[model samples]
Target: MALTTDRPITTAGLAAQRQPERNRNVGRTLRRLPGYAAVALLLVVVTYPLIWLFLGSFKTQDEFLNNPTTSLPDSFTNFANYSQAWSSVATYLQNSLLTVLPSLALIIAFGTAAGFALEVLVWKGRQTTLMLFLAGIMIPGQMILLPLFTVYFQLHLTGTLWPLIITYTATGLPLTVFMMATYFRAIPKSVFEAATMDGASIIRSFISIGFPMMRNSVLTIALVQFFFLWNDLLIALTFTTDDAQRTVQVGLLNFTGQFGVVEYGPTFAAICINVLLILAIYIFLNQRVMRGLAAGAVKG
Candidate 1:
């Protein structure tokens, strides 16, 4: 036998063997380039209008009219459009705040309690109650608009923010309760049992344990409800005839018409302001909202 030598493969040898596989993966990724390019192009198509609107908000009417497609303004520091927009809708923004804040508070409180009770507590007709709440989601808002208007008119609430608050809270309930209940159901039963063993009442347990655990869900509900209430032009227009009682959505429309000629810069500025407010809230609470949605989808 020729001097037989046994040699073990080193890590380098293994890596060399794997390099072909890595190269193949890289080639596959490259082959999917068209798909990625399509997705990128779709995103640009969808977002271009929003980008244009934002940039247009900064331009003077003459500049915008002259070069409507221009991406940048001559002066980025000019804020007259923003000032004019804010001044026009200041009261409507206040009205929206007044309507949305109290309504959100009530929705959270009631929805949390209702969900916790239905999911965690042992009771008769709980399923039926849940079904009833779920049924509200199926009812088209337009179908109820006439009846709601008539009711509000009878109660002399059509001209005030109270009707808007009540309607928003009521309409928001089905989804809020559904989301909250689904999230609450996902909590382990042992947690509640442990709280009970510690001499905690349902109320105390919910306050101490459930609330913290479901914080993300609550944020999600708040975010959804905020958007719903904020962008509600139809309901605001239907209920609020007075300019003083109008929400920002209605105010923006009225603002556009006030001059008998549309000032694109100021109008776009107002739209941008509204969009920014919602966008800011989304950026802040987005992570929590996603967590809440994921938790809700876990079991129900």
Candidate 2:
């Protein structure tokens, strides 16, 4: 049998005990109220634009002209704008894929190899070489644009996708190398050493061990480079002379003419499509990218 020395509590005593807890709870809620309000405001800030864009895509040019901001679409089922936009952007979409995909592959391939060699392999001057590569990151793209354009014009590569591909690959590689090198540095050198002792070649060791371990980091770099390439208008417009070679961003210009005439509905539709594509990609890979960034932060 269990015995307890206890005092019977009066109603007033229980109320006294609960009063402090209630006050403390109210105080905590009051303290947190501003944070909740800020989050709600941020949600509205981000969400309202997307909702507006979606609604605007369904509206007619007249509807937008009369009341662009306050008016809702007359019909949600209207899809004429999408058809018009798609017809114009189909080739542009293809061109973007062709250019961005190849550059992405080249960036990853060279970056990973450079990172592995720099961090995993024992060598003199590796740090100096890495510094040289990192220096590229600080150089602004605008500084090289005119020189690159002149060279591309001489080479007859201005109208082709080669300029875009080469530009993206070269520019993206330095940062990729930096990120990948940091990741590779965090890994144990002994792993590569053991692989070496087991008769594995450096390439084999990188392939079998290094690449697999840094998959998440690779994805992060790919996503970043993809976004940069996909949304680029300045470079695409400067290099691409032909309509067939234009990117999606450039293709969106088709809906506007020189006389101040703009096809607002179709333009909004195209913008929506472009944004949704990138948004879908981000949503799919967001978790992995977050994990990679978190791992890098912890390792650093």
Candidate 3:
């Protein structure tokens, strides 16, 4: 009889056996190199203007004017442009904060409450109310511009930040409500039922349990509203006639006008500053925004 032998498969032997498969995968990856290269090229093309704008911010007026095609500035450390730009728009920046902060607070507070009431609480006309809110989203902002302006003008609010605040808050509501409601709906009905059994009021349940559970949705709403209010030029321009009440967008436009001739360095620097502020906010809250959106999508 032939001797029977059995050997355990060693790690090295297993790896050797898989080597061909690994090599095939690598070969497939290599075959996709042209696609990767094209994507990289596309990214560079899309980003080049922003990069140029940032680099141009560092150049002196003369350097920017004389060497429009040049990519680098003579002195990267020169911050005079930024200082000048800030000096020009400091009050406008303050006004922006004043307008946006309160509007944002209202948007989150009322939006979440409305969403909870619609989704978690049993009520008459809930579906109708939700339909109304959702319908508002379909209305064109431009369609209301003339009527809104007339109303604000009659109220003598045209030159003040109040109109901007009110408009921002109002325009932001439909989307906020929709997002929050979608998020709230994804929550199990049993959660609210348990609260009801415990003698918890709708307000109490919303404040305690709902708020904590919907943190991601709240962040998403906040981020969206923040960007809208911060970057708003059309509303700001239409509503605010006072220089002191101008937000950053109108302020930037005025900055160009104040110089009579455009000062490219300071203009670019101001643009860079605005872009950086938005970019910083996005970077900081990006994870939360993604989480909120994903959670809402999955749950809704």
Which candidate's lDDT is highest?
A: 2
Task: Score candidate 1 by TM-score against the native.
Answer: 0.88
Candidate 3 local lDDT, 78-147, one digit each (tens): 8998988888767878999999999999999999999999898888999999999999999988888789
lDDT of 1 by residue, 232-257 (tens): 88888888889788899998887764
Alpha carbon lDDT of each predicted model: 0.88, 0.89, 0.89
Model 2 clash pairs? none
Span of 10 residues, lowest total lDDT, candidate 1: 62-71
Error of 2 at 211 (Å): 0.6
User: Residue 229 of model 1: what lDDT?
Assistant: 83
* Residue runs of model 1 more than 4 Å from their true location after superposition: 1-23, 66-74, 257-259
- Per-residue CA lDDT of candidate 2, range 1-300, in tens? 989999899999999999999999999999999999999999999999999999999998889889757689999998999998888877789999999999999999999899888888879999999999999999998898899999999998877899999998999899989988888878888898899999999889989999999999889888988998898888888888888888898888766745878989888998999989999999999999998886577464
